[model samples]
Target: MTSDRMTPEVLWSMGRIGTFNVSPDGNTAVYTVTYYSVEQNKSHSVIYVLNLNSKAQTLLTTSPKSEYSPVFIKNGQKIAYLTAESGTSQLWEMNVDGTDKRQISFEKDDISEFLFSPDEKLLILIKEVETDASIAKNDSDLPKASGMVINNLMYKHWDTYVKSIPHPFVARFNGDRIEDSTDILEGEPYECPMMPFGGIEQLSWSPDSKSIAYTCRKKTGKAYAISTDSDIFLYDIATKSVKNLCKQADWTEQPCDTTMSLEHQAVNHQQKDNNVGYDQNPAFSPDGQRIAWLSMERDGYESDRTRLCVYEFATGNKTYVTEKFESGVDQFLWMPNSKNLCFSGVWHGKTQIYTTNLKGDVKPLTDEVADFSLVSLAPNGKDIFCKKHSMKQADEVYLLKGNKLEQITFENKHIYDRLTMGNVEERWVATTDGKKELCWVIYPPHFDATKKYPALLFCEGGPQSPVSQFWSYRWNFQIMAANDYIIIAPNRRGLPGFGMEWLEQISGDYSGQCMQDYLSAIDDLKKEPYVDEEHLGAVGASFGGYSVYWLAGNHDKRFKAFIAHDGIYNTQQQYVETEEMWFPNWDLKSAPWIKNAEGQMQKAFRESPHLYVDKWDTPILCIHGQRDFRIEYTQAESAFSAARLRGIPAQLLLFPDENHWVLKPQNGILWQRTFFRWLDRWLKPDNK
Candidate 1:
């Protein structure tokens, strides 16, 4: 085989090239380069600048420290990025030539998202301030007797939990000086509504640099903080006053119990549109006269109807464009001239980019794009800069001109090196929602076409996520394939590439339909020759964790075993007790789930696998970190107790200092080893 056929050392590398920012002249582009070493089973990132004019690339930073999200600032001579080294993440800005590297933020410790302003005058970074609410008077500091007998769900789902740690405000990227800056909107450790995390996301400075507009989440609650709704917020620099641009819905009066919504499934789903709240991605019109954004007429988790509202700042006049257009709009950009706008949204399940004028004249701009990212038209409106990920590759940046598509990066050129072409097959199946789901089938190291083998199904949990089709070191289709298991992974519904309906559909009913969808995907796999249904098992984390529980209860007889890393089993209780009040706040309708516990309990109880422990007999594995602030350890504890009460097979594993997503390297390897061991014991072809 030619060297070209062999994946390049540089090509077969890390995570992804993200945070693409074009230079002012559009000749130089800087993007993030990431890769995860499987042997190391760790993630590393760096910044690279690619020059279109010279066809040259410059890689920055020295070894040991990973830099990400590089962008040209201060007239394109310097770039600002977030760097993680020495166990701390802080702001750093350096010259284009990689000299004069200086640390900007002086936080003793932090993880932040930062950007240089359009004018390059100030640097803005989102800092997560960890406050120890250890409660000096807590029952004890010597670790309580947490030895709850393991249950089937914990063993089957591989469930885990962590103490609630503070989450930084969402979408709260402020325009502040990185060196010595005042926070625009920061999460107060003890705030009730955890709306800050995404409050300032999708932000763009007004052309005049006078103010900023962003989407903010505010939940009216007395219990920990939850965002009953998200709305548009306008912050004026001069007056330093933050104005709530929309009316606040009386969520309190109605009660926020997840179960008791009077609205029908469809009605509850469309709740984002009611006057109470509506909107995301607030972008200022190029001319600064108007702002265009997405607003849900109905604001439920799965509701699909959203409008493009053009707000005239001066006159306070609002005009709704694309009225009742339900296909979800994922991303939008102001056509350089601001006369026309280009946005990427879903239509019939596939993500397609559309261009429209202020009058609402819309046209399907691209026909062949199955998935799209970075949907901005070139300054001339002649082309759009986007990364199009096909079944063949994860994502690639493409320049869509008048009649042709130009590939901008060759990042994935040798992604499939060393793998036989015939062994890598792409499969498509229908998800629970009737949308077409895509999956990649990788045969074992020496796969025989006619042979059947045990298969492993891996699911990733996120509102708009896929099972990670791209190459990875720790876990990917290829990694699983090497482990002697046919990886029958599916990119199920509710992923961004599919569009808004599928993405939003799984919102409120996270454990509801999405869980069923996982079951459907496995059922579909059973029909394939290469898959062995009788020897099937599944693994997922976070949202995927919730699904494992949902599936374990509803479809335990289907799998030999299960693993749910950081899964939530008891939603009714989890809805209130979790640390980051915001998750429960946003997921649940209001707060004090106990208020409607009678009905909410019935809803969660009906859905919770823990409530129906009698149905679970499958071996399960549960994992959690005592320090996790996202979903508390009690969730898994509550789940484990129920599993054992019913005398189901279960095992519980606890990490004293880990969080939502395992970060400690030593523990990650341990978790993965234990998880796969449990899988091998149950799903191993030889074991049987």
Candidate 2:
């Protein structure tokens, strides 16, 4: 806490702000902030209710256990949230003043998430349901058996095996408690909210509260693994019937369906089009006339552009509202008038707010160089409330009134005021393909031009994710600068924010122009006298990790050190080892065993980092988590093995109790420490 510069402990000490919900009358807002306890190796979340008018924030929960996902209920008189105070997760309600806390749902199962209907008569509860029958625990003779029978391809997902999946259940709220709950998915072996990342956002209620719209991919096992084909379903409460809203044009070719009715029900016409990819997060209009959700065009491509699609309830016509935006919409809010929708999207290295009408006419609301997430609108509907953050700062609530963005909740202001953050500058570097790509440059706190400093080339992950003004707990640019290393993050090929052409360029050509762009950005910066060209390093996670591995062999001694976390060392092994088959099938263009006439697959597999280990001479550090199914730990293990076998200086950091991301407080600290220790050993030789 006494450090003037950013450090691992300092970064972990800062409170992280999460999702918030505005009260009914828009007078109060309840949000959650999570704090990590490194000593305890855990974290806790606390909820707070803020008066939007007075800007007075009050802590609503004082329990030792974490309380989060707060929403205003009973006409803003009570705040409802989920907590584990009773050793099991359940719904708890309290007054706006944080008194009279009482448990509502006493179900035997834990409620992962919950959403109340607009009329407050019905409640949607999300809980895990064990559908797989092959588990050893279910056998009468195998009471102590811990093995799982896997007969299908999606047996394991992001971190855990496919034993239980989340399903949405509809229950009646009779004021005091939830009752008469029934699983909307009944006996289906599918995930309603999906897996890994989906939550309550995938479920919504209509204005009348008689129907529930939920997102579900009704496929199981291999079919689920190789497709991104999720659909929106409308479930009627009275008849207990479900209808597929985003049905395929060819019903016979449909991978899955949730229709429970035998006869054709005269309702809103089904969206029978070739709209295949991911169609989820259905949001109903205030007037109950339309529903909007983010949609992707391709079926297997996960990084496809997420267009905002609206379905008119009256006409049964679906319209792509923000097709011309050229990028994906991250989050959106329906205007009070219901004629327009405001959304947040990345464009030119910034995630800004934009307003679009039903006619596809878009207007920029805020063009600042920081990332903004759409929260809600004011009572008057003209002003917008959003969470804004940048590379130099964490998340803080902001009110966008007309054109001005005023900071409302300074959740991390105390930490920010005490720390000296590095300055983040935006630069445009010319790429090897003759394109000007956006790159972010971070300088040390109180930077001096007379001093030469080591530098790091930050390769972005997601492969398609933008190198925007994002604030992160790990891979933080400001923290790297605080360590006395200038950081260059380039929005290279395959990253969004630059049109589809640039974003799609790195799909099959992983070791192509994108790697050159990383070199381009760092090469352009090394020309500066203040930058120590002799002490350059490259680092990344996921696909960015893949970039570092590829660059280790192709960097031509331009980099002194390399660090790859959960990256692919062998493309052939990754093609079958990854849980999501669609990712590899689409990005790598084909299975490794198949003969791709275009030679794309051959090129992709041939360029695997394990194959080029002979050229690796720089000191490299490899890290991975055993639970990470997306990119298995074997990838990192093989990379480290090959590096050492080639007589290169190498180190391996493995985390057994972690997933694709190092989530635990203590594990995260270890990651940062090992990260710096490796970099300092090679890149910071002068300082050592």
Candidate 3:
């Protein structure tokens, strides 16, 4: 291996730029840059303002507390960002040249997210408040509860217990200080912006700044267990009134009754089995006369197609603008004219920008290749800026002009100039069932066609998510290629961007057709003379991890080694322990205890990787995080136990502070080192 190649240290040292906000004049842009310190094992972010006219950038905030979410306010003279310099994340104001920094909010609770009103006189902030304030009251004489009391279905979320829920608050900002604050959803049990990954996108202010629209769940209790019903609510700031825009007649506001009778037959059974939908990401048009948001058609199905919808303020009418659009919409914004919208969505394994009108007319603005996101449109809607990245390059700001993309930022140019990255090529392979799948291969740097190299097949997690041209921090193909290894990533049958039918094929059959597709991909790769057939390895995370586990038992002879990260070994137990019940319920088609044909206790059990553990013979490496509530830590324990019991060579890597993904700077370095070492032990023994 060469010392001048791209390594984990070099990758971590590169700055990560995100959240762009163009000034009103379009002469400048403000964005956040996050830099990590591997030695300190911490990250610090600061805001930077780039002068489009001079092509010069200036640091806007030098706060050590980590500033982010930079936005131009006060007619582009001053900038506002969030910082924890005051012990909690609060709104802070500073000059455009990184001067006159002042704290604006003095709240006891930490602000999750905030947005300035169009008029700049009010600040709408989202804060998480305890359900019972008394529980959080610090009584020095009183002892804290040793154990958590569970009483609700949502007692826990992704990685934490649900002790408090996020709510919105309206504050009157007088440029220097907050005059007063009012809780918008004070008495409601709903959480604005929903949970998990929701952010500022869920809240929107009207053009006049008189009303605000946000998304929240209307159903509680067991309804939440199998329901994905989230509705947009309009709150009038003047009258302090709220209305559920998506609520239907006869909708009861009462809490669910869970009491059962002695006979277990006379219990409260009035709960309706309704298949409502999810509506979120509300954005008001420039004219403020209409509101646009993304909506899902069916309830309880998270993978349902997302359609763009618009609501007219004057007519009180709603319309679906993307009903005919085949792909799901990820993020979008209204044009300045308020007649059209620009959005980014996945198409053929790539995310491209597109334009759509209220009449449902959709047109692609970019090609169906290379990953593009974090779109920012100028005030005139003529200039568009987005972050673009590919297999060979990291994300850099690019300006979309006409049909050509102009790179505006070269943050990683210095790092790229000194390193020799692999050559990436896209290929289409035919599966065993005669279906063509998209696969990407990366050849080692300074490669020769006559020489064979060890290959590592990387499976994506989503099972439904496509492994596009996006640059990944975790499963970096460049680093693998730098280690003198060929990397192969296949977009199999169950992945997205290939149409709805193909994506839903893996549902209720995780180990069936998808496994065959993977096997077919590997067989196709072996046909190439540059691939070493004798030293093949497989690696994946999440669903991909599940696939690796399944392959370890059912087809171990094909690969020399395997790596599974946060994978499900026991499908039956996964269904019962996962926090998100709807995913398992929909994927498996029923509860774990439900019986199927031949008196089998759960149809998904047939696809369980644990069932075929007796046939396992391959050496494997298992990686899991204790904070991964989605898959739970027990899955890793069970996998490692099975491998050790079978007397097969296996190793376990556990992260106590990390989540599903290895995010921290130091942890990421450790993860990469461990991963490459495991692969080297079996696949690259000669190098060792």
Candidate 4:
């Protein structure tokens, strides 16, 4: 019999739920459930329609191919979705009750994402078009030549080499067929939806359906790689003209006074509302009089505060709504009344829903300890639906009607029922810097204070990502606890949900106070008699991975084992190898050779993990994906090699086909098994 505790196999067996769309009448919702098959080593998504009133659900599609992005169309009488039954993804429509299914689009290229206009007479579809001539044209000339002639800076991004770019096409739909399609970007080399994670979220149609607001950086090559200055563009469908909605007053037409230093020139440029940083995910109000989007103030700081900015189309006036929120907005939706908007922002240690009006008054709507994200509002606008998840449970749809929240979906109820979850307790410990830090302590299932349990220090990546009540498949706190180990995840000096000062402290100070914050959390927890202080371990990926490597040399015999995944081993090597130059330049404060005002480079490179391998005494497991261009796999290999050379008992788990994340099912399982196997060896000596 399988253990009643949650395991890697049980974790993978559970179904995952995605975001959903509500019908126009708000009485029903359509969502997708994704299930992974270990035997097939793949995952498939199936769409389902649920009556919001009666809590009745009906599976809509059963085709072998996955059907997703279901939306109610034709006045809630029909449902439209995308499927790949014809070998290439295309638009398909069906009756609301799951009947009269038929293909509606026959475009040559695959339709990655689509959105119908408010009137349902127009449609916008996202398709990958070959824009880079040198990459695609030359490839056809030499079909077998594997060599790529690189001439641009953004030639490669994330995991794949840049070739085809996704563009939005506006076409007229006459119920059965789409006609007179026009590429909004036309022949421009820029991507409308952006790359990697962006999709339909980057584009929003006006209520009048006469114009489309899209997010695009409009830069290529080196310019694109060094900046995060994407702007929101308003494209008029009838006039075939585009205008930059976030453009400042004559900043582009007026040349900057270049006599000053580059630093001084940037400061001068900041005087205007140039919207220098990322301005994306435009959402037009239901009335079509105003448009709002998530905007970041800094040019290269991707982790900058994402303020909600609203722009009035008539007056061309912009208001920074939610300025009082302090923290950043994750997602927002305009209320049906158009006077108020609901948004989700992080505060303390949880993401909660808040409402803000045009006058900038913010009010908390829900204050649950768990994170709540805005999904869709009811037709009445008073009732809202959100996706809520905690450290112990995965995502599930919840309906918020005033003070009452009802669970609308139970995608993994079966798995959850059979297993017992550990207790997640939030504790605030005093940091070495004379500040209080929040750390979540998760005990093993049926934990007893009489017995000693091994503990793990969970360092977070993004260096700026939140250590909130997040439910992640890879870094799940519950799974670690299920293995009879205590987990201490800290919202260190660099993590969000604390405040801006805390979040920005990690930048240019990777091995500084944030490191102390991690130590403080573990040190405080290890003092507990129930914790096995001698067998502590540190594990993280990306920036967190960098933390593990740094801690290994400087942990002072505090930890017995270390696991670093796709972490930065050498600061000098990472500066040149990484695709995005802005990330390292901002975080490290300068290039490897150049010295900043504070001489951060000297201190940053001086403390690189590769430099302090002499102090490593603990066993380590380094896992990395070869395709992780953000932080190359070579970082992990170098760490692993240095450990083995020092005879510190190291293991390297490399995936050539994977990226920064172990996405494949089989690889994920292997990762979990190897992770526990290594931990059990050093941390649980008795088990070995």
lDDT of 1 by residue, 367-477 (tens): 762566653556565677887764335566778886478877766565555443325566777766665676666666667768787776676765445553344423445
C-alpha RMSD between model 1 and the true structure: 7.2
Q: Choose the strongest candidate by TM-score.
A: 4
Cα misplacement distance, residue 463 of candidate 3 (Å): 3.0
What TM-score, computed on C-alpha atoms, does each candidate reach?
Answer: 0.74, 0.96, 0.94, 0.97
RMSD of each: 7.2, 4.4, 3.9, 2.2
lDDT of 4: 0.87
Ranking by TM-score: 4, 2, 3, 1
Instruction: Report, for all candidates in order, the number of backbone clashes.
Output: 56, 0, 0, 0
State how far residue 74 of model 4 sits from its true place (Å): 0.5
**Candidate 3 on 518-556: residue-level lDDT in tens?**
888888898899899989999999999999999998774
At residue 86, give the lDDT of candidate 1: 64
Q: Residue-wise lDDT of candidate 2 within 381-403, one digit each (tens)?
A: 78998999999888998999989
Task: For residue 554, give model 3's deviation from the true position in Å.
Answer: 1.6
| Model 2 weakest lDDT span, ten residues long | 258-267
Superposed model 2: Cα runs more than 4 Å off: 133-138, 248-250, 254-272, 597-601
Model 2, position 261, has a per-residue lDDT of 14
Q: What TM-score quantifies how close candidate 3 is to the native fold?
A: 0.94
